[model samples]
Target: MEKRVVVTGIGAVSPVGNDVDAMWESVRAGKHGIAQITRFDLEGQKVTLAAEVKDFDFGDRRAAKRLDIADQYALVAAREAMADSGIVSGENVDPNRFGVYGGTGIGGLATLESEVSKCVKKNTPARASALLVPMMMPNAIAGNISMEFKAKGASFGIVSACAAGTHNIGEAYRNIKHGYNDVVIAGGAESVLAPISFSGFANMTAMNPTTDPDRASIPFDVDRNGFILGEGAGWLILEELEHAKARGAEILAEVVGYGATSDAYHITAPDPEGEGASRALEMAIEDAGIAPSDVDYINAHGTGTPYNDAFETIAIKKVFGDDTKVPVSSTKSMTGHLLGAAGGLEAVICVKALIEGFIPPTAGLQKQDPELDLDYVPIQGREADLKYVLSNSLGFGGHNAALIMKKYED
Candidate 1:
């Protein structure tokens, strides 16, 4: 028989707030985190806004100076999660049975850019620091997290763009269900709020042009333009049912099922038909052995982009049918787009919604897009007795991932 997996702890370092409670409160209150970019000079950039982690002091200046922002975010969030789970040493849980699975879209881009600038100014490759390569690598966050926690089993990173965080949690769930590990620290982190990163996205016309934080990421609204880039990290502690019970851990929510698919049509754009996304939803529902109607709420991958919002609506309709009145919302309206960390943060929101009995709303949604009509819990959150919720994350590389989380029960 396959084992079951449950979320015991969650940690977040997000634009809206530094910790999970503060972040969730901001999300629930419909507060927007996007603002004018201040990390670097934005003189010639068309897009000058982002949702950045504000007033974050990692406490240890030495570690802060040595590590990249993404790595620091991951480590901080992981430390919080580890503390919340109360699994510090090998007394209750074996070190070999613990694992780490992290994800990121563009890891340490700021570090790479800084090192390159130094090399160019000094006119020599030797000017770059020896740690430059490791710092810039996408897997460095996971490597550092594993070493920090002493997780000796199945330590690695997932790099599926925006779907990365969901993929990490999904894969970690599978690992525990199959008895490969008893516990896993899984999530995604990203901090690419640099001039080069902004310029690239702006050049592609992928980011929102509006400077107003509240209106910038207006998903499901007819006036929606595009997503606002954001930075942060989200981590969760997932453990086997028996192991958690043996230790008397507080179960937050159960990860019931996961589904991943590829559009195989475009590199950056989703298939207009949303066939792949629909299939992923179907697969996740099937995997959970639950009917479509059973899912009470949906945390949409609503990027506020024209193509993404419409295509995601089509996919949701295809799976749950047009008549389904499932309340859907995009937390990105407040948190902006956390890239690889989007899925992880959204998953934490889903679990929180289950536990708190309330659904967060899409912050800036005013006039709903007529063509895409659904109960998109607009403008404000509402109290709901949610039993099961699904969170979707669609990435740039035709990657589509869905995770089903249900209220934990004995």
Candidate 2:
């Protein structure tokens, strides 16, 4: 028999708030986390804003020394999650059975930038620190997380662009369901609001370069222009149902289904027909042994880009049909696109919505787009007795993922 997985703990360091309770409060209130970019100088850049995690201090948790920002973000969330799950100590628990799955779309970009600047200006006199490579490595986030927590099973980073975070969580669910591990720490971490990342997105015209921060990242709206970049980390502790029960861990939600597909059409744009995204959603529903209408709330992959919003609307319509009556919204309107970290952050939002029985609103969506006619909880968040919510993410290279989280009953 296949094992069952339940989420026992969730920790997040998002643009809205740092801890799970604070972050969920902001998300439930439909607050936008977007603000001017302050991670680096934005003097004359076309895009001058992003959702940055403010005042996060991760001290001597990893090595009693310096660590990369992304790794630190992951470690911070991991620590909270372990504590929440009552698995902080591995004395009786088998460390070999604990696993860690962390991801980031563009890992260590900030650290890389800093080191490059150092190499050019100051490296003439001496060699850069040996820590540069480890600090700047993309996989360092996962490795460091595993080392910090001493997770002995399945420790690695799975980078699939914006889908990286969600994919990590989903993969962790799969591992636990396969009986490989009883507990898993999984999520995505990102800190890519650096100068080069901003400039590249701006040059590619992928970012919203408007002066009005409130109106930017308005998904499912005709006036929507582009996605606003954001930074943060999210971690969730997945434990076997029996394990959680034995430990008296609080169950947040149950991971019922996960599906992934490749659009195989565009490098940056989604298939106009949204065939892959639609298939991915349908597969997730099938995996959950549920029908289309069984899903009550849909946390859309609405990226605020013209192509993504339109295509995702079509995908939802294809899968849900008149079930379009279902409540759908993109929290990205508030949190901005955290890229690889988006899946993990949005997963938390979905889990919280399932537990709280309220669907968070897609803030900043003032005007509705004609092409994308879906029941978007625009501007104001709504209260609903939601049981299952589908969280979706479509990333570059046509990666599409869908996860279904159901309210825990037993």
Candidate 3:
């Protein structure tokens, strides 16, 4: 029998707020989290702004001392999610049946940069800490989460650039649905607001150079520039539906379908025809056994970049037709682009929208792009009785992912 997968708990450590409730409230209000970059000196960088998690404290002295920023963010969010799901100490759940899957675009870049700089200054490799390799590996986030929660089942990392977060959660959904595991902790985290990362992105012209917070990330807007670097994490506790119900877990939403594809066109840019992204969307809708029109909302992979927004718009039109009026919005307009964490955070937002009956807006969208004609819930949120929501995440290397979520029924 095919098992059903459902989301029982969510946790977020974002730039807007440190916790899920606070972040959701800010998102609902269309608040912007972007501001001056504080992680490093931005004197020579073209992009001086970012959405950085402010005043973050893990509250565990050991974790604070040992973990990298991304690992710390992942651990904190995972802890909150596990607690919210009432899976205390693995008493009711088998630790081996639980799993961890995490994603990150540039895991522990800050730590790597620091260690390299120390080695350079000391003129010897001995200056680097013994923990540097484990701390900087992309898999560290998932490994640490698994160690923290004692999840012995299939713990691993997903590293598909910006699509990584969505891929992680999507893979976790599949794991539970196929009876591989009863519960999975899945999400993405990133903390690359350091000097090297900032300079690299700025020089590549991938980040918005605008300094104004409100104007920095206007996705799908006429004046859209580029994405704003954001640091944070989002985690969800996904479980088999029957297992969750048996434990009296408060089901948030159902994971209906997932689709992932590659453009094979450009390394850093989306396919001009948007074929890969369109196919992913079509596959997800088909996997969900629903027509495109049945989807009420879309959390777009709108990074506020010219190529990304335009290509994504073309992809949406291709999947749903040009005239289809499904309301779409990019929470990145407010939260900035969380990169690998974008899909994970957006997935949480989709589930929340299904539960809360309100669709968040693409904040700062004063004037719609004349080229793109779609109902992008602009400037403000709207009350909507959304049943099924789709979230997209397009990454570098042509990676595209789409996830379809439905309000839990019976």
Model 3 misplaced stretches (Cα beyond 4 Å): none
lDDT (10s digit) by residue, model 2, range 290-332: 9988899999888899988888888988988944698899999
Which ten-residue region of model 1 has the weakest summed lDDT?
84-93
TM-score, one value per model: 0.99, 0.96, 0.98
Candidate 1 matches the true fold with a TM-score of 0.99
Q: Which ten residues in a row have the lowest lDDT in candidate 3?
A: 84-93
For model 3, residues 79-143, the per-residue Cα lDDT tens digits are: 88888888754786788899999999879999999998899977888878888988999999999
lDDT winner between 1 and 2, please give it. Answer: 1
Give per-residue CA lDDT, model 1, range 1-410, as digits (tens): 89999999999999999989999999989998989988999899999889999999898998777789999989988888888888864777898999999999988999999998889977888888888988899999899999988888898889999999999999999999999999999999999998888888888888999877778999999999889999999999999999999999999999998999999999899999999999999989998999999999999999999999999999999999988899999999999999999998899899999999999999989999999899999999999999999999999889999999999999
List the global CA lDDT of all models: 0.93, 0.86, 0.91
Clashes of 1: 0
Q: Clashes per prediction?
A: 0, 0, 0
What's the distance in Å from true for residue 154, model 1? Answer: 0.4
Task: Assess the local accuracy of residue 403 in candidate 3 as a C-alpha lDDT between 0 and 100.
Answer: 96
Best by lDDT: 1
Better of 2 and 3 by TM-score: 3
Model 1, position 324: C-alpha lDDT score: 83
Please tell me which model should have the higher TM-score, number 1 or number 2.
1
